[model samples]
Target: MYIPELYKNENQEDIQNFIHQNGFAILVNQTDGKLWATHIPLVLDVNADGKQVLVGHISKLNPQGESFKADDSVLAIFSGAHSYISSSWYDHENVPTWNYLAVHVYGNVKIYTHEQAVNSLKKLVDKYEANSENPVRVEKLSEKTMREARGIIAFEIEITSIEAQKNYPKTEMIKTIKISFPN
Candidate 1:
């Protein structure tokens, strides 16, 4: 994520909100000399030590699951609204660009224990099902249904760094034109 100073967003509140709003993210890592990516729902969580972490699960059968080692680094990318801005829309000559909001989280992986995984799943379900007419609670699920949790790998990423970028053409043009067309 190349974040020019002008477009870089360092506000923790904004970044956290973006991740929460766009919980479904692309998790990327390398496994066995090859790159693998999985689109999964990741929720922001605070670890016991009070550090922010991203929590999610993937099928145990997914090869990417094997890539989750304590020392291994992974990237979670959350993307928001984006659109192409034609140069013709600008008042001055300019190249076409895209306006978008994105956050890149880099962290080390931590595979959760069965108990921890279950708790994570419960939190995830509770978060998303809050507004449903008939909300589904993980605790209310039958044993048979809960057993299915065994088939998944739940983990958390201990956030090492976060890079957020918000690129709007109008905002960028103000900075650009100031430098390009000085009075």
Candidate 2:
């Protein structure tokens, strides 16, 4: 979250797109006296109040889920492609570095009710299965399969802040290098 001014991306549109493209994010929060983290697919949505939120779920057996409380602060990190930039790539001597894109979303937790959780799960399924050749839907799922939902805890994070960063070579520099290397 320590983004240098030069690497910071303040474009809201780009940040949202990044989150959508990299929907699997690491959710972090403090539980009891220790830090808890869960990697899950989170979808961005607008609530009935028109406030943006991130929705996701975790196994009910997960300790992280047991400790979640309304208004508890949490962090969701979405990471994108990264690669090592060798010092040899530069004309002058320089240290090697890594370039990547990432977005850190801060929010407050809001546990969903049973009905709300089911609805959220339905939307999540529909979103991912939309383009599948044989798409499956929550409404069409068998009762036995749907009963498994009882074992999970769905929640929403009311977004409070977002910090996005992209650390990469300038476009012209990359183009020039590609032209020189002919690859």
Candidate 3:
């Protein structure tokens, strides 16, 4: 994605925080020379090597799940608050524009085994259920449900590069004030 220098944001902490806040992400990849995308929730963690990792799963029946393989290039997108900006809001006339923030994470895909998938699912549940009065842990799942989960295709992405951008009106535009004097 093209990002102007003015809007470019490269803070590692900010990127990580955004991912955690918006765990649901869009996964984009190429399959059979065609573009494919999947929407899923991801669990973010840091490995011993201090590298960031993303884990998620897709239905085994999803064709895109089969298309992804280890070492393949992939992109995970996390979008933040966004809204339309009207030109009328500016002190001077200007074209309407959209103000928003987005982070693009590029990585190499790694398909995880059944056991790893189960662990990842538990981590996801733990993260989301942490605030509940009675947290529902993955271990509490019924045997039948666990069996069904085995049919899922779990994967991890080792983030190689990340690009974040925040788009908004220039400070001058937002601060501009109109003052009139009687002629």
What local lDDT does model 2 show for residue 144?
98
- In the range 81-114, model 1's lDDT, one tens digit per residue, is 7766667666678897777789999998899999
After superposing candidate 1 on the true structure, give the runs of residues whose Cα lies further than 4 Å from its correct spot: 169-183
User: Which residue pairs show collisions in model 1?
Assistant: none
The TM-score values for the models, in the order shown, are 0.91, 0.91, 0.89
Window of ten residues with lowest summed lDDT in model 1: 174-183
lDDT of 2: 0.85
TM for candidate 2 is 0.91
Candidate 3 segments whose C-alpha is farther than 4 A from its true place = 167-170, 175-183
User: In model 2, which regions exceed 4 Å deviation?
Assistant: 171-183
Q: What do the candidate models score in CA lDDT, each in turn?
A: 0.86, 0.85, 0.81
Highest lDDT: which candidate? 1
**Model 2: which residue pairs collide?**
none
